[model samples]
Target: MSGTGEPLFVADGERDRIEVLHVEDDPAFATVARRFLERCDPSLEVTSETDPREALDRLEEESFDCVLCDYDMPGMNGIELLESLRESYPELPFILFTGKGSEEVASDAFSAGATDYFGKSSDASEYEVLAERIATVVEKYRTERQLERSEERYRRLVETAPVAIAVHRGDEIAFANRAAADFLGVDAPAELIGDDPLSYLDTDDRAVARERIARLLADEATMESLEERYVDADGNLKHGLVAGSAVEYGGERAVQVIVRDITEHRERQQELERYRQLVEAMGDGVYALDADGCFEMFNERMVELSGYSREELQGRYAGDVMTEAGLETVEAAIQSLLDGETDSVTVEVQAKRADGEVVPRELTLTLQPTEPGESFAGTVGVVHDITDRVKRERELEAQNERLEAFAEIVSHDLRNPLTVVEGHVELARELAEEGASGEELVPQLEAIADATDRMLSMTGDLLTLSRQGDTVGERHPVALAPLARDVWSTLDTGAATLETRDPGQVEADRTRLEQLLANLLENAVEHGSTDGQSSPDDPVETPADGADEGLTVTVVGTADGFAVTDDGPGVPQEDRDDVFERGYSTEQGTGVGLAIVRTVAEAHGWTVTVGESAAGGARFEFHTDG
Candidate 1:
């Protein structure tokens, strides 16, 4: 194209420089030819080589854009040099400029890989043809190299892409990348060649996939991303978002499909939906606020907890629900999160109900994550009504204080009087032994000593009952049968038999449960007598008409919990309701034991009740389901 003498229009400045190598046998001829070529095209820089051998050496040393050589040479002709140059510099432009003008030589120049041939004579215009040929060939070569580089970069991009990409040609896959092969459960991309892409889609999605593929292949329009179900080679169903567009592949129109595996994303979306439903139905209040602390979104539970309608709470500030102090605490926590000081925080606050009641609440606030340099966005909050919890904590504190006072009384007032009584009784016994007057007082002194001992025992019982048991922390699986037998062996029962039936394991505090069993068994041994006798070793000589035949205590597991029963005169129906009260006893026994049993049961969140057993005895049933 440049040989027609039109401008080549190369870039301005130094980029227009083109180097040319000229080989001729004669020094004068080579010199004149180089000057003529340079004068014709100011952009060309021509170097002369007298011998073809020297020209080959120069080519190996330096680079040139085009080569100009003559036909006749000492070692090698122009065509022969070109043949050798083609081995290493195959694409370098070579032009034959020789005085021997023959069809035979022209044909030989081209067949030997010369780019262009021109016959040279005494004509100065022939040099213009040589310059034109050099410019045209060099421009074409550079452009073709640039295009190859661009194609190489595009190939790398497609091969290394993150998402699955496949090109389909007439219902069969022509190309697939590694991501596509992995998504389709194939070992390599080559394995997917000539496979129908539609075969990977699930039955319900095949028709939609076909329609979208048809639209793209027909050059109608591109299809937007659509979620569809597909099956892998392992027959496991998965979710993908597919988008398709028409593309040229191997000189034919084809569909290039991009599939992004959305299975995990879809599952996460579904899980969030389920959590959203749960938040709406939960008893605690869940709400979101903007950076200014104005309500943006809230669950139904928030409305109920705040005693405000959706219309009333929407767009309202946090001050509508929390007091000023609580709002300040929440704001401070949010600032801490925004400052990267903490992840989340829980603070106690007072919430004002719509009914004008201010109740204690525990608010847990967490700031939503944002970009590193972004300001605080908002906060998600969960509010728990802690009114009942606060009240219970105060009651437990008072109960502990009362127990401390009772312990002080037992240790000082009651013990001092008992010690004095024992000292007097010993002195009276010593006086009787010394044959002093008033020796008859010895028997009365012994009786007083027995009463003093009984008082001491009752004092110890009071201390035992005062203990409400430590906080029942972390319940564990405890077997009941072994615990019952172990406690029964430590008791002072002589004839009272113990039995455990179907006493399975339960989740309970082991130490507290053992204490409960000990107290209950002791109560049974003390009252399980038909003749209303205190000692289990002493038999009832003349049994009452409708009394129990013998004392027997049994512990058995129930569906909801467990039961402890004894074959004795059952507690009266009138006294059943008050039996668990402290210091309430029917016989000559401290009621503190049963009261301890009730305290332990309550600590474990179990309800204890007194009823008549099947064998006409008092049954204490502990239900844990509440």
Candidate 2:
């Protein structure tokens, strides 16, 4: 098979042995043929057989590289003997040596699988040519036999490989092994023998996969190993890690594909994604650094906390966006983790925002170690923004001090004066009732009572605002339909029917959700209706010019969350953001209503924006986490 250094035929001067079985019934012709073959090649090994039956028996018992037979025998002719020899030993070269030189006989000899046909001749040169032809036939048969064995061995190995193995010629799969057939969900390799491999991929991926394969074949280079998905015969999907290399098979250039199943690996990857989502859903910021102390990955909260885009954080050093002091502290902590002195460390540090503001963050750093070592592979950090929390703590401490001071002032100064004033007023009223002129005393006493009531109301509102800031109540999915009904029922607008649209559910605190609905309903009732004039008793009658028509508040659910639209005068675009600010009121409002709306919305991680409504009025669109 591998004709590396083998000679074509034996040289003339060498002691070559060519076994020739001369089957001739006549003694005279047999002697003549023997002498002629010896003259042609002096090293010829000629053996004459008079009986055709004996020669046929010898072929079965012994092996010869070449056989010579004669035609027109009594028992068995040359053609019949050649057919028998071919069936038993097809690779052994056979030459027909007969006295008959008819064209019909030569054609019949070849048809019976004879390597060559030679007849009796007196010329020595013609006999030499016959001998040379026989030598060439023997060498050719030997090479062909070796090639057959090599091909058989290769076929056995390819068919029994564990992984899918396929040979692709250009775009078609020329040959696919048994494993390839099973991987493709086919019964046998023959089913995919001539099919295009790219047909197994999805339509979108077929063109790209084909281009990659073509490029690999064109350059005669191996394709890099990659994880890819393919559709099987049953229309089910299969994931695999595939590697391809260019090779020569069956005298043609082709590519070989080796594929390993990786479905379990892909499933594990999906599970990791689910865990990552659970972590990102938390309020606190979380991030991971690589072994080189670079920001490799982070959650959405981390991006919001730092006020930096994910693209900007990736590949950047961890200390690049931190304050100078914070950077030094973080670096030292990381070094400690890398040095194996700590498994995890927590510290308070300031993170510098994109706008150059330094926000205090409580950072908890844990060393994520590599396998079988104390050395750190990276660090996982959970950062909590404590700016508002710290501010609230200080404010609570200050409020406690103020409350104590207020109590002291009221006990010693205000309460004592109030008691004296109350006694004086009572005495003056009694004297006035007894007919003493005391108009000024009566007016002063009423003024004191009004001032005291006003003070109490102011204290109650302040306390309510403080409590709202301190408590983050239980949050759940609040159905907007019932909440809107409750707020609408409390409205005091006479003769006005509140039209409520289908507002879907939102995740929010129960009380805060109720408060938000209450504020919007009250605003629609108070400002949406006319200032003073009353409407007619009949619902069909319209009010006067100064009186307002009944307002329609439409609440619609959106993909993001919900929207509330009022058919009232819309706010100008320039004042939309300012309207949400504390103490910003256009209609002499206490200005705490919209501010409370904003605070509650923000507390529940929702966004509220003002825009023009479909009714050509102010629309407030709010979104909650769905």
- Number of the predicted model whose TM-score against the real structure is largest: 1
RMSD of 2: 32.2
Candidate 2 matches the true fold with a TM-score of 0.34
Q: After superposing candidate 2 on the true structure, give the runs of residues whose Cα lies further than 4 Å from its correct spot.
A: 1-238, 243-245, 249-251, 258-261, 325-347, 407-626
Error in Å for residue 488 of model 2: 47
Looking at candidate 1, the ten consecutive residues that score lowest on lDDT are 1-10
351-392 in candidate 2: lDDT tens per residue? Answer: 898789988889999976565643556789999989998888
lDDT of 1 at 168: 91
Q: Least accurate stretch of 10 residues (summed lDDT) in model 2?
A: 532-541
Q: What shift in Å separates residue 493 of candidate 1 from its native position after superposition?
A: 0.2
Residue 177 of model 2 has an lDDT of 80
